[model samples]
Each structure stands twice: as structure tokens, then as C-alpha cells.
Target: MYVQSENPVEITEAILKMDIRPKDLIVLLVAESDNLNLQALIDRLNEAGVSFIGGIFPGVIHNSTLHKVGVVVKKLQSVSAPVIIQGLNTSDYRWPDFTPTLSGLEKKVTAWIMIDGLMPNIASFLSGLYDRLGDRVNFIGGGAGSLTLEQKPCLLTPNGLLQDAAVIALLDYDTHLGVKHGWKRLAGPIVATRTSHNIIYELNWEEAFTVYKNYVEKDCDCKMSPANFFEISKCYPFGISKSNAEEVVRDPISVNSDGGLVCVGEVPENTVLNIMKGIPENLIAAAAEAVEETLNQSAHNDYVRHTMVVDCVSRALFLEDRHEEELEQISRRIKAVRPEVSPQGMLSLGEISSYGEGYLEFFNKTIVIGSLY
Candidate 1:
């Protein structure tokens, strides 16, 4: 069951009115960057013995309509355990301490993860998790942050609100994952000559921003400047290629004073990078394809409990007015295949999934769909 309301109090009231006691709940909320009172809302849900895991996104999908400011609550029937790990900034971040807890769980488990989008060491965190869990658990989730690109206490846990931390909900159910990013290479197999964490200082021995500016100005016929970097860079992102899997895109958020580029994820030194581009039609088509892939891989086609979509907000910002069309495309495609499955999603800062036999990755400008059975 799913419910939506602009008022948090109303959301709690509606959940209380339900006759069924939900084993777990997932929340997708849209509120002013500074106005979100997650603690108050969590307290209300806790009083009723309702456990939940989710975060505040720029916008949320309730049914087929997208709401910029509201609460979308998904009542999950499967039993779940929510775990919160703090101190993501500490250099000693380790997963072995939590290995015993995860090993004690049932053999079959699916994890939904939400981490701080602005955390500098997201790649390290992901590597640690994949090393510990391996293919034993299926993963699907995205980064939780504000549209302003500021790191706030957005991720919600039963303990309260948190920042620079990650939350995982281990579900006792089967899930099928599908991922797609619809971005074609614009130019460059250029090498990243210099980098520090998430900032790229140089590409092919030239200043990173200089290389990027020349490419954008030449391809798009638009003059590039630091003030207009974000507006122009959204249409053109950086793609890191892999041998067998689709390229992982990194969104350039801004340009630095030293002519470096700041991206959503790390751009390791010596890594090959390509400028990627996308359009509305291809992006919508990719979303439909993602739905088809998920349905094809589902274990129980006759009874899919729910479908969750974590699409990058950069795509939404790029599509602008036509963004709703992407959602409608996904809805139509899913309905054509499985009319019983309902889709709900959030426009995330970044996306996560391990489709087919691929390793889990944190992607930008991508769409990830997961179907639970």
C-alpha cells in the first residue's frame, strides 16, 4: 500500500488509520532544504511501532504523478531490519565489524542502501561493502541529498536523523535489478592526468576545466564560463568505461578556482574518461528498457509485490517539462508486461544497482529499477 500527503502529520494520521500493521515502511519525502523535520516525523512513526528507512529527495513519485513537496510512504509486507552505521568520514571505516551481524541473517536477503550524497569517500565505502557482502546479497539504492548540493542530515534511521552515514534495510524477499544510463560518448578517451578524490585537476596534462570547456564550446557551440558551468555541464557528463558493462557516468557539479572540476564521484588518476551526452527520447527509451529487463529477470512474474525506481535527479533537471513523460513511459511499459505491479520512485542524487552478473556501482545520470517478489 502507498500513501501521500503534503503534511507530515497527515501522513502519520493516514498510516494510523490503516487496519493492517505494516512490517516495514519506506519513505520518500520532498521538502524545503532547511525545513525538513525528520526527527519529529520519525518519532510519530516510532510511537506506533512502525519501522521505516528512506530519505528526503528533491521530488517523489506517488502513483504516476510527481510531487515536488509531499510524503510518499510505501507499506512493505516483508519483515525488515534497518541498520545505521555512523562515522563515514573516519579513516578507519570498516565493514568487518558488521560482518557477523550480516552473516547471522537468512541466506536470502536484499539490501536497500541510502548514503550521504556529498560524502567524499563514497567509492571507498562502496568498495568495502562489495568486498564484505560479495554476491551474497542483492543491492539497490541511491544517494540522498538536497537540490542545493549541500550535505544535510537527510538519511532517516530509527535512532534519529544522521549525516555522513549510511542506512541499510535488509529485506527477507527476492529482488530483480536493472540499470541503464542512456548516455553516448561525445568525445575523448582522454586520460585523467591529475586528481584528488572527487576533484579532477587535469586531463591529458591540461587543466581539467580547460579541456572540458574546449569540448563543450566546440560541440555545443556555447561559450563556457565558471558561472554557467553547472547549467551547461548537466547536458554533458563524464563517463568511465568498463570492458563488459555499460559506462558509469559522473556528474560535474561545478568548476573550481584552480580550473579543476568537482564531480559527484571520484575521478581517479590515470583513469580514461569520455564526455557523454543524452536527449529526452533516448532517456525515456532507456527507462522503458530498464523496466523490461527487470520484469524478464523477476523470479515470480505472476506476483510482483512492488517496483522501486531510483533515477538520477540530473536526468529530471535535464528533461525539464518533459520529465513526466519519462515516468509515463515507464508506467505504460510496466503495465503492458505486469499490470499487477505498482511502481513508486524518487529522483535521487545518484543511483545504485548490480544488474545481471555485474558488480555494484554508484552511478550518476542513470536509472535503476528493482522489483520485489
Candidate 2:
């Protein structure tokens, strides 16, 4: 069931009071940027004494809530359980369980892997995960969120706390998932030309700023150039490729002043890009289509029950208050169309999921859904 409240601990208490058992700890840890509030939520997780771990994302999803980061716990009572494996004292316990999950499965199963974005080995970790999972599973979700000037982020751990760690949930079962990648296409008519690899070494084959200046235009554009990414961040987003389906598997992350694009995950080199135009209607259509596919793909007949969304924080900068207005209808549509739909979502930097749980060919794309029932 989808639920939300100001008190996560109370939420846990409610779950524990319900049919939730200690072993069924499939909790998701996405943090709110506010340090103090994040700590309070972490404190609740520690008290729960559940074998749970997750990386922080830009936002958290629950029944009807949108915006801001939060934590969620979904307990599978009568549902089929995905394997939960943790590496206690390994070199990097983060990807240990994922290898088996991806390698063995030939169909589809989704996994939620929380990671350390600042880690030097982060790209490597993702690579290992993608390699092992193969086409049988999909990868989504994200690295933890942080306001820290240092590379380290406060990871929410099992001991009533947060730490710098990684966790994975290998869900190989009968389930359905849905994902919506909404970008505000805020940048004006500038094009991402002369890009080798996914990194924009040069825009228009000229210095990056020159390319940017050409886009912004005018004298005010010069001074604003310093924080160009900051100003137009809401509208212009960096598109990251999830599936290899050319335009089909792509989304954008925002850029920063250091010439480094602060995308959700690493935007690999040589990735073709576009300085997109964000139209409100287009964004809504994309979201609706993604959600519809999930419903259509699963049919909600014998087993479809819950859906979780992973959205980007940059999207909010563009949509402002209207983002939720557009998203609420998403909830309504799912409920109206799918009788078994129990949808809860987070408007965060990224999401994780897998499809058909048993479909082996879905490996390595960004997983948007997983099922335990």
C-alpha cells in the first residue's frame, strides 16, 4: 500500500504494528537535502532494526507526496520475495549481490542499488552492475544526495544513522514497474555540438563558454555566463542515456559552472546530445507515456499491485508548482486505468527498477520497476 506522513518513525511503527516482519525489510532510503531532518529519518531507520540499506536520492516517493527527499519501506507479506544479500567485509559490498542477480537471470528483474557518487570507484561500480545484470535486468535509482563540500555524503545506515556506503536489492520475481523521465528542456536554442564522448569537451568546437555565450547572447549573457548552469539549470538539462535505443533511452541532467555537468549519474563520453527545448506539454506527454507503458505492459490482471517513480530534482526548477499538478493526474490515471495499481513515487534525481521480474532480456537498462508479489 502507498502511504506518507510527516513522521517516518511513526510510519515504521505503523508498518511494524501491521503484518510487517523483521525479515521483510525492503526499505528505500532517499534523503531530504536538509541535514537535520535527514538525520531524524535516519534515526528512525536505525530504531527499526531491519536489514535495510539504500543510497540517498534527490527526492523520495510515497502515496501522494511529491517534492523533497524522504524514505520509504515496502514490506512484502504474501508476495514473492526478491533475494537480499549483503557483503559484510568485502572490498566493495555494494555490487556483490548484483552480480548473481544479473548473471543468472535471462529474463527481467529490477534492482535498487544505492551508491556513493563521490567514490572514485563509482563509475566502476555501475559498470560492474551493468555488466553482470546484462540485458536481463534494468538499472535505475541513484547515488546519495548531499550538501557536503567534501565528496562524502551522509549515507543512512542500519544503526540509527547515516554513513558512506552502498546497498543493493536484487529483485528477481513476478512484478511490473513504471518510470517517467521528465526534463524541463529549459535552455534556449543553443546546440551541444562538437561533443566527443558524453562530456562536452567543447560546444560548437569552440571553448565551452564561447558556445554558451553564443547561445545566451547579449551583454548581460556575459556576466551571467559564470553561473550559466545555475540560472538556466531548471530549463536546460543534460540528457543521460539509459537504454541503447538511440533517442528512446535518454534523459538530461543539469550543468554546473566548472564545465562539469552535474548529471544524476555519469554521462559517459561520446554520447550524442541536444540542447533541448522544454515545452510544458511535451514533458507531460513523456510522463504519461512512460506510466502508460508500465500499465499496458503489465496488464494489472493477476499480479500488478504497486508502482514507484524516480523523478529528477532539476525538473522541479522548471515546472515549479505546476510539476505536481501535472503529476497528480498521473496518479489519478493509474488508479482509473489499473484496478491493481498502488502507485507511490519520488520527485528525485533518479530512480531504480526492473521489468517482468522474470524477463531475462531486460538487463542493463535503467531499471524502473521491481515486484515482490
Candidate 3:
């Protein structure tokens, strides 16, 4: 069952009212960036014996409405174990080192991952997780951070809150995942000539911003400036190509004085990239298509209990007034598949999923729909 309320005390009371004891629960909280009482809320849930995993988001979805200040809870019907790992820095993190810790769990496990959105090692982290778990473990989750862009202890695990770290909940259940980013390549597969970490210094042997500005100005017919970069860049993102898979997007956060571009995730040197753009209608349609695909892949005999939608906040910002329409599109499709289940989601900083066919990747300007049974 799903429950939400703006008042912390009221939300806790509602969870306690549920007569059926849940083996686990997932919590999504949308609070002010400067709110310092987060620890108290976690302590309250811990004292109540609710095993949960989630984090702070700019906005959360409950039923069909998007809320900016509230707590959304999903009571898990099956047992789950949350593994919290810390000490994740740009230089010193490996998935193989953590693989041994996940051993001895059930054969059919679904892993739900939540990571710091600002962490520069996200690409390496996803690659390492896929290398260790292979295709045996199904997973879907997103980056957790506030609108302020400052890193903090946003991820909540059973132990406590975490920052610059990741939390994984290994569940013994079945799940179906569908991923889509409604972005089309606007320009060539240009090579990233010089890059370090998440900063791109040059593209195609030219200044990164120079090339970016030329293409964007030509495509959108608008002049580019540092002041208006974000406002205009939201409609245009960088797409990194992969073999036989949909392109992964990276949102450029800002431009450096050296004319380099700083992105949310790493843009490795020699990586081929394409300038991408999306229309609001196309993005909404892609979300609906994702829901349809997920339903089609699901086992017909098994009943779906809950659906989790993790979409990039960049898309939400792009949609603006039509943001709720995107959610409505998802709801309409999900209801057509299974009217009994309601979809709950959040505007994530980034999205994570692999559909159980390939290596997991951290994506931006994308939508990930997951069905948990």
C-alpha cells in the first residue's frame, strides 16, 4: 500500500495504522534543502521498526499529483535487506570489492540502488555493479539530491543517512524494467578530444563550448551566453552512444571560464557524443511507451503489486506546465495494463536500470518504469 502526508507525525501514524505488518518499506521524502530535522524523521521510522530505503528529491509523485513537500511510502510485501556502503570518492571506489558482501542472498534478487547525484564516479560505479552481478540481478533506481546541488546525507538506509555513498536493497521477488529517453541526435558522433572526470575541455579538437554554441545557436536560432546556458541547455543534452542500446544522456550543469562544459556524470576522453534534443510531446509519449513495454515484458500470470517511475528532473523542467501531463500519460498506460496498481515516482537527478539484458548505466533526461511483484 502507498501512503503520503506533508506532516511527518501524520504520515507515521498512517503507516502504523496499516493492520498488515510490512516486511519492508521504501520512503521518498521531499523536504526543504536546508531542513535539518531529517535525522529525527529517520530515527522515528527506525524506532517504529520500519525497514526502508529512499532519499530526498526535489518533488515526489503520490497518486497522480506531484508534491513538493510530503512523504511518500510504499510498504513492501516481501522481505528486503539494505546494504549501505560508504567512502565513495572520485578516486577510490570499486564494485568488485563490494560484490563479496552481496553473496549468499536469494538466487532471484532484485536490487534497488540510490546514489548521490553529484558523485563523479557514477559511470564507474554502474559499470562495476554490472560486472559483479551480471544478468542475474535485476535493478532500477535513480540519483538522489536536492535542488540546491550541494551534496549532503540524502540517501536513507536502515542504518542511517548517507552522502557520497550508495544504498542497495536486495529483494527476493520478481520485477520488470523499461527505460527510454525521448531524445534524438541533433549533430554528429563527435569525439571528446580532451576530458577529465566530468569536465569536457574540447570536442572534435575545438573548444567544447565553441562547438556547442555553434550547433545550438544554429539549431535553436538563439544566441548562447553563460547567463542563459541552463535555460537553453535543458532542451539540448549530450548523448553518448552505445552498441545496440539506447543512447545515454548527460546534462551539462555549467560552462567553465576555460570554455569547458561540466556535466552531471563523467564524459570520458575519446568518447563519441551527439547533441540531442527532445520535444515535450515526444518525451511524454516515450514515457507512455516505456510503461507499455514494461507491461508487455511482465509475466502475464503474476500480478503486479506496485510500479515505480524514476524520471530525470531535467525533463520535468523542460516540460514545465505540461509536467503533470507526462505523469498522466504514464498513469493512463499503467491503468490500461493493470488498473489495480497506482504508479508512484519522483523527479530524479538521474535514472538507473539495465532491463536485465545489458550492463547498468546512469542516465539523464530519461524515464525508467519498474513493476514490482
TM-score-based ranking, best first?
1, 3, 2
Give the alpha-carbon lDDT of every model: 0.79, 0.48, 0.78
Clash count, one per candidate = 0, 44, 0
Tens digit of per-residue lDDT, candidate 3, span 90-144: 4565443445545655565677788888887788877777877777777888888
Q: What lDDT, from 0 to 1, does candidate 1 have?
A: 0.79
Evaluated with lDDT, which candidate comes out highest? 1
What is candidate 2's lDDT per residue for 253-307, written digit by digit as tens?
3344545344434334444444444566666666676666666765544565556
Shift of residue 359 alpha carbon in model 3, Å: 1.4
In model 2, where do residues sit more than 4 Å from their true spots? Answer: 1-12, 29-48, 55-58, 67-71, 76-108, 117-124, 146-154, 159-165, 175-199, 216-223, 240-262, 352-373
Residue 347 lDDT in model 2? 47
Task: Let me know the TM-score candidate 2 reaches against the reference structure.
Answer: 0.71
User: In model 1, which regions exceed 4 Å deviation?
Assistant: 1-6, 18-28, 31-36, 77-80, 94-107, 355-357
